[model samples]
Target: MVSEPSDAAVPGATVARLPYYLRALRDLAAQGVTTTSSSELAERSGVSSAQLRKDLSYLGSFGTRGVGYDVESLASYITVALGLETEHRLAIVGIGNLGHALANYSGYEARGFQVAALLDASPEVVGTRVAGHVVEHVDDLAAVISRDDVSMVVLATPAHVAQDVADRVVGAGVREILNFAPLALQVPDDVVVRSVDVGGELQILAFHAAARAAAL
Candidate 1:
């Protein structure tokens, strides 16, 4: 595995595409494919070969002239580049439907994330178990976060409570967040927040589908 240079600065767009390349490399490895050309890797990742090459260039050269890249090596390099080399513990607040699903997701471990704690404001949910974790009261969020060594938080609460929960999480010293709430959150400049708006995504897909039908 190639060590990413500490001083090398990768762009946000390139950082986003790193996961796709890693997934494609893992898929190739699972198929007993030991090596892959940029074209083949790009095809698997749904990006053009040229685009893939450009993105990979930010991580420094690795592929051979005629031989191509070793799948495992490339995957490992991307893993380190994306900061997935170590496991990140996550605390999912709000034991509602969305929160429960996120806690139960098996894919997190494969991507170097572990659901370390679950919290909810509701008294009924506080003592209940979801995904093998006893839901703690949000009142003790700071303690739970520190105790579990939670490095990231997933906010799946309602729009009204999401910001309040986010504030609490940030106050607890967690810098990374994945927000599934519909509304935008106001976080400090140092904190990184990635929002997943399911409704907005579907609306975009619907617009594309309608445009395709209209052209036909």
Candidate 2:
């Protein structure tokens, strides 16, 4: 019974937290739970009940007054909102240790990302087989992308050269990019880039530990 927004403007924080809610709802469904109260879902998603209610309001009112939300229906709605309805063809560029590990991960398949190709600049590594797909050379990127119809790419190249590789991918018509290199990338407004800053996360964890020690 959630109302659809005419413009569908979902806040960034709400969008990011949606996956947590979806995971919690799926867990509830697995346990034979059909309905859940807002407080229960909020606790599972690590958010306040009021915050969860506000976040869900963006997608219309799908909750009941006393019985709460339908687990299956809520999970389905979040899945659709997060665009997990279709499989996205993807490529992993750089083929370094991190890239190699990511290429072998089976989790991406479950999340709707299909790793169609793996690319690298090293001739010694190129043509090597990893995770059932042949590692193609970066020079052959356009051809590989064309052959596989890759819609997104993960950049695992060195931080210094990640932007150059990004430029190449953008030139080849890749609009969605996930960057694992420890640097920011510049791309045209038409293209979207999401970066994983591992160092920053570690620093935040260190800061929290320092704060705790200082309080002690």
Candidate 3:
């Protein structure tokens, strides 16, 4: 299980690059590349050689001086560091357009996340088959959470309902949440909330364009 951020904190930049390193390592491994130099790994991950070495140094010196790093060993270390070794239970809430797409998306399972259930507030949409499983009513969120031992909730609800749904998700003892709603959600200090606003990103780009026009 990916426990809360430990008292021993990792640098944010280092943490961010770990996933990229893991991805590169996995690709290399699949290609029958057993061992890789820091330079090669850096090229694969879009990081400079020195920066890659520095980031890996945070996980202790795993690379051999003369032979470079063992691909399998490095992959194992990064996997454990990112808490990808264990299967994480996840649930999708809202089951609207984005939510429905997420429920059907096959990529989450590849990254050690298992979609435990699909939930929506509408009775008309509920009980409809999504990816493979039918959507369940949001009234059953707690029941599903308990039955499935979901530790993470993906909030795909509308902005208006996002916060309330977050409160309920946190109350259900979920520790981590991925919010796709446009608005920010306020949660307890211990609860981790990550937001991904597609609309917000577009709006920011629009502002940049307007600013460029003004500069002209």
Candidate 4:
């Protein structure tokens, strides 16, 4: 990660959504729009205006009274606040279909996260290169992680393997994990895990929808 500016520790939730705000601002700028009101930004981000304003406030003084904010300026502020102005090294494990997609994907790079290495347990997939990083055997995770000095790890392994991979990653000195598997992991309190389980989220939405329908 970039030299974290003293002002970079936005709330966890705010840090999570600053990229969305930055992207929306860029889209507006691309459309030839120069400025926007908080309400407009709120619409773009699917957040309430108050929340949007508060999040922006955490970054810095971004808006002007009555005039709102300049799209490009706001985008720049959000990017800097999220520590995306500099590059971060990331390690990817589980070279299956999902892992391959992440390795090939350019979104993380655009946000200043560089995929420094890829690892998998299967011998067949080892020695392969995806997104310019040669795939190494999972057994090499510790050496690769330490060698690359990566702080973030992406776990795209199967659910059963997620915790194991995460454990190794923690032991190897990784501080943050982005897990795509559908299982909870055991990690030190200092290590942060962000789980992205599509099925679980879908099920939660279904439950809420059913409750809303019943209320209606």
In order, the Cα lDDT scores of the candidates are 0.91, 0.90, 0.87, 0.86
Model 1 scores worst on lDDT over the 10 consecutive residues at 1-10
Q: Write the per-residue lDDT of candidate 2 for residues 106-190, one digit (tens) a residue.
A: 8887677899999998889998999998998898888888899999999999998898889989999999999999988989999
In model 2, state the lDDT of residue 104: 88
How would the candidate models be sorted by TM-score, starting from the highest?
Answer: 1, 2, 3, 4
For all candidates, what are the clash counts? 0, 1, 0, 0
Query: Per-residue lDDT of 1-216 in model 4, one digit per residue for the tens?
Result: 112234656688888878789888988988999999999999998899999978876766667788888888777777777777888899999999999999999788667888999999988899977888889998989999999988799999998888888989999988899999989888889989999998989999999999999999
| Angstrom error at residue 106, model 1 | 1.0
Deviation (Å) of 164 in candidate 4: 2.3
Clashes of 4: 0
Worst lDDT run of 10 residues, candidate 4, spans 1-10
* Candidate 3 lDDT by residue in tens digits, 99-206: 888887888866779998989998888989988878998888888999999989999998898888898898899989999998889988999888898888999999
Where does model 3 exceed 4 Å of error? 1-8, 203-216
Q: What is the overall TM-score of model 4 with all chains considered together? A: 0.87
Pick the winner on TM-score between candidates 2 and 3: 2
**Candidate 1 lDDT over residue span 51-132, tens digit each:** 9988887887778889999899988888988889999999999889898889899899899999999999998899998999
> Which segments of model 2 are wrong by more than 4 Å?
6-8
Query: Model 4, 78: alpha-carbon shift in Å?
Result: 1.3
